[model samples]
Target: MPSHRPRRLVAALVACSAALLLAACAPTVALNPAADANDPRCADVIVHLPDTVADKTKRETNAQATGAWGDPAVVLLRCGVAPIGPTAKPCITVNGIDWVLENDPASPSLRYITFGRIPATEVVIAHGKNGVTDAAVLPALADAIGAIPQQKQQKCLDTSDVTSPTGTPTAAPPATSTPTPTPTPTN
Candidate 1:
């Protein structure tokens, strides 16, 4: 028994170590991004545009979207005209995902579009130098990017409407109806 004591102690230590390792690698439950606004993993979404689109337009759109959504943030990374034509514009890749933008140079006045997902597909349209967007082509750009519905994408927008009010109102008294005198007494 004396000789086997050390062997038993070593086996016990090995068993404890194996248990601890398995516990550390246990599967974790998934959490929703919207419900878990404080989740560090869920950050703001960013969209990178081609070189042809002007800087002003990119800033305006990024600001607008960020103002609308309260939780997830939206940012514009780049804005410029596509070096090549609309169809041949180099695709911007993010997180191993590729985004295709139309860069039709024949209609240089058309807005340059970029697509991305902050958990939802976002289509960014940039006005050309002339400030005129190709109505027909612009809508298709959104379609090509497969933009999500406004309501669906709103979950990712940072809306500042939430705030704490300073003043508190007094409680109103409950209303009571007065009863009319009975006419039976006159009879």
Candidate 2:
């Protein structure tokens, strides 16, 4: 038989080339490591990240404790960030996880910082004509983020908790599925 060894070598080389091509097709996203990116709690969150978010496949990210999804990276998640303090921004609970919305003036992205979870997790989601909404993104991440234990003292309280001078309770705000923002570019 003619040089069967040479044929085997050629087949191996072809398979390697195909793998390299596929790897090159998916670019690794660049991101900055959070303040406590090495926190053990963050590892818990990373391990639970879903393979897909809002119908987009997860992509590789360069930074530790960070994740990106979508071919163009419409959703970016960073864990082990500085925990957020009390803020006047809107706080919403999804799947038992509380997230404080970071309102960016005139920006097309909805940034959410975990409210009571230590070694905080932050998720920046592109929302607009070209991107998915918070309704789709937050719920998808709830299980992954729920890994970080919430501090009992810092729970999110709604208007229902407020009382007037006569001790009469105020009506709770109508529950919204997600925070609504005007459509704009994420850049």
Candidate 3:
């Protein structure tokens, strides 16, 4: 019994050390939540996030509804951002979700914010690392981001859908038909 106790203690110590080492390898990512971070819809988006995105494994984040991937965090996602209206910034639809591109000339990262979705989501992808591209990163997160429903009035549109100056849709004029000549009365 004495010999068995020593063996059991040694096994337990080994397991604890291995766990600590693994935990140390993955550090918690610090992120600031959006203004509407407390929105319940954000929870839905967070839960649906994939374990791996763009070949980068998901990292634990300190803030609610926030996600980070890759050792240096090439992709970062935050839900519950302020929803945006129609904008000139390019908007693209991926996997049934629409994302509005936000470009900053000086920044190396590409930022995308979900358009038309209530409690919008924002994803930032830093380029020149992990061979990540907008094509790959956006689609990977589309499923989780799609959890937020898009508001019809705020949806993205092409030039053809642009409204007139008065803000109403430009519709074609009503068709006019030639009237038949009236019969002349006899004098």
Candidate 4:
């Protein structure tokens, strides 16, 4: 019986050790809440238009303009009209294009919209990748810009699968009608 007791004790210790090893190997999990899907604060951006798009003749003028703003970290040109929120201000206009400036100094949170302008030369600054931009605030900017008789909102890119390169066909399911049965009267 004493011999049996020692064996049982040894087996129990091995089982406990195995359980502890498995627990240590378990994957870690994050307990924090998921990020917000509709955060407006995420949108903030600034737009800078270069003189080339503005069509200034002299190279000195272009250099002066470029030097005036210093070198922006990220720039996107000739995309679409970025929307602007109420808080934003029209900072400057060069060659008929309006540039909106934002107050964020740490990093830009603004996006520029090319609106199909030719010879693309525009600069954009925003906080992080996928940061806020005039394009990001376009819904609100649309209403304000709409007040101008000449300005109209451009249609967004077609997101439908029809434009997909794969050309894969998707067939609609055939419709079926259920047959109605007449109830027999109980005798």
On lDDT, the leading prediction is 2
State the C-alpha lDDT per candidate.
Answer: 0.35, 0.92, 0.87, 0.35
Reference-based lDDT, residue 126, model 1: 31
- Tell me the tens digit of each residue's lDDT in model 4 across 1-187: 2568888999999999999998665433212211321122211111222332212111221121121121222323222233443333334433444444544445554534323222112344444653444443333233222222223442222335126566778899977798779999998
Candidate 1 lDDT tens digits, 1-187: 2598889999999999999997666333222223322322123332322223222222222221221110111112222222222234544543333355455546433223343433233233334443433342333333323322223222211235437678998899977798768767553
List RMSD in Å for every model shown.
Answer: 24.2, 18.6, 8.5, 29.5
Which segments of candidate 2 are over 4 A away from where they belong? Answer: 1-16, 104-106, 164-187
Clashes per model (N, Cα, C within 3 A): 16, 0, 0, 20
Candidate 2 per-residue lDDT, tens place, 1-187, comes to 5779988999999999999999888889999999999999999999999999999999999999999999899999999899989888889999999999888735798889999989999999997777888889999999999998889888887879766587878899989998899898796
Q: How does residue 20 of candidate 2 score in lDDT?
A: 97
Tell me the lDDT of model 3 at 77: 93
Off by over 4 Å in 4: 1-74, 85-90, 103-122, 125-187
Query: Per-residue CA lDDT of candidate 3, range 6-81, in tens?
Result: 8889999999999999988788889999999989999999999999988888999999989999888989999989
Error at 155, model 2, angstroms: 1.5
Q: After superposition, how far is residue 44 of candidate 4 from its true place, in Å?
A: 26
Model 2 TM-score? 0.78
* Model 2, C-alpha of 90: deviation from truth (Å): 0.7
